[model samples]
Target: MLAVPLLGLINQYLGFLAMIAAIVLVWKDSPWQKGAKVAATIAAMALLGAVLPDPPEEGAAGVARKDRKAAAARTLTSPSPSAAQDDPSPTTEPRPEAADYRGMRLDEARDKAEAAGFGTSDHNASDDDKNIWMRSNWTVCFQKSSWTGSETKTIDFGAVQTGAPCPSTDGGAIPWPTMPELTWKTWKTARNEVVALGVVPTEHLRADTAYLNDTLPDEGKYDNWRVCATDPLEGADVTINTWVTLELTHPDNGCPDPSQSKEDRVDLPDRDDDGDPDYHDPFPGDRNRNSVFPNGLPDSSGNSSGGDGSDGDSWNCPRTRWC
Candidate 1:
């Protein structure tokens, strides 16, 4: 069997080339001696072919060797999830919780507070401008201190829209809560802190005209209030509970109006250059300044008119009171 297979292999090579050479020699009518020379060359190749291995019989040991090599190759190259399953420890750690108000509008503060376990007991917005005031309550469970009363923590938030002048008018929609200028003012019993986030406008006003005209004598033109502190106060381990009052104020002197009114009168030039009616109240009866009542007095519309406008709902603690 080996001799037959080796002869076939030799014929596939030397015999094929010799046949072509013989055909060429016959076509040229070469001498018969040239054909004998080609035959001799083919026989010499056949003798050398006897050293080569024979083709395997059906399912023979040679065939089994090839099959084993293929199987070993596949085993070496294939992927296995066994190592991954054996690992009990995770490859990656759990991620941290993200901020709740990372990029939302300041007007959404109420919704965020609600989601964070605060109840919206009172909500009001001033018509004169874009100021919104909200009073919310949250239940308290102190670890050590007795519940003489709940502590009141005020989180005053204000938002304003600033952008290129609108082409169509309608005062260009106030972009509240979206691309809004956000300011967070916090009051703890005695200390107050204000923080500004995002792009602030150049013409934003920080002080009411009254305060600017009265307290700051050297003011040329002021717009928007910057946060007084470099860092935000940490809200941790806080006890001694009572209702906290949050009041948004003019960026200038940080004082809440007695009635919680935010109106500011500004003088504008008359159209015809007449001096008689040169000055007018830019924002008259602004609700932002007047929404909070003094000592919880009700207005004509049956709304609280007290200085704080918080009424009995305010948790008046030993150190702080909400107004």
Candidate 2:
């Protein structure tokens, strides 16, 4: 009981009552009775303090605590009638001017931004389809907004989840190859198909490549693992080497059905005259130029073998002019 003398910090009244009871019960005792009576006197003095006009309490340890509490009460319970109008606690905290949403996942971040009671806007964090919000697997990697959270915001989310920043603005959309059924196809073979479709083979595929010269036991040199799945599933308009997810697995999963005609529905012909044909060229619709801009001339044997003039010569290749 002596060890916990300060336990009544939570309620001084209860402490005083306990001290009084102890004094009465030990009234006839010797040393204990004397100590109880002394404690009872202190408790009674404390009770008197709660009712009387409080003093500018002294700085001694006990007096200081009482003074601090009394001052706090006085500050809150003004003698003037205006205490009812004075608020003790602040109602709200200052919100951020522009919430830093970078690295934040979209589902939760969107609600946070909206709840700020500000005008809001959302944009594809990445033009790359894989970074879509509804997919519930993307995050905000970039954002633009006014000084206030209450203004229009333009945000974009993307590959940051893959531990990279926003998409590179370095390249533009090109004519993409029809997405081949990549599932169960050897990565080496699938890689070739991507290249043939006019993809740079390096950007997207390079990132996924894992050289397991030591293919899993019994898996031959040819067993460099097959692609379990391909993103931009078959025929989705894709940038040649944009972010494509090649979900790969062991070759034992099975090989691609080579039986599907390599020619079936393969739009290999150049409907347009600019060297890159419909399948490999972005502007297969335009007859005079190959891309969004001109100068995309036809080439042969990996060499630029077209006319130097402004108009393309669809007529003049000496060898097989493979676009």
Q: Model 1, 1-323: lDDT tens per residue?
A: 23333444666555445445545655466565876766655654554455445766867977898999999998888746885477656567543332343123444554665565543322111122533332222111101111123533223332222221111223233222121212333222122221122222323223333321222213433224322221112332121221222223335344433343334433233343222122231222333222122123344565543334454344232355333
Q: How would you encode candidate 2's per-residue C-alpha lDDT over 44-129 as one tens digit per residue?
A: 55654454444454557688788899999998776555654674646775535657776677666667777765455555544444
Name the regions of candidate 1 deviating beyond 4 angstroms: 1-12, 19-53, 60-110, 113-323
Reference-based TM-score of each model: 0.17, 0.23
The Cα error of candidate 1 at residue 24, in Å, is 7.7
Quantify all predictions' global Cα lDDT against the true fold: 0.35, 0.50
TM-score of the candidate numbered 1? 0.17
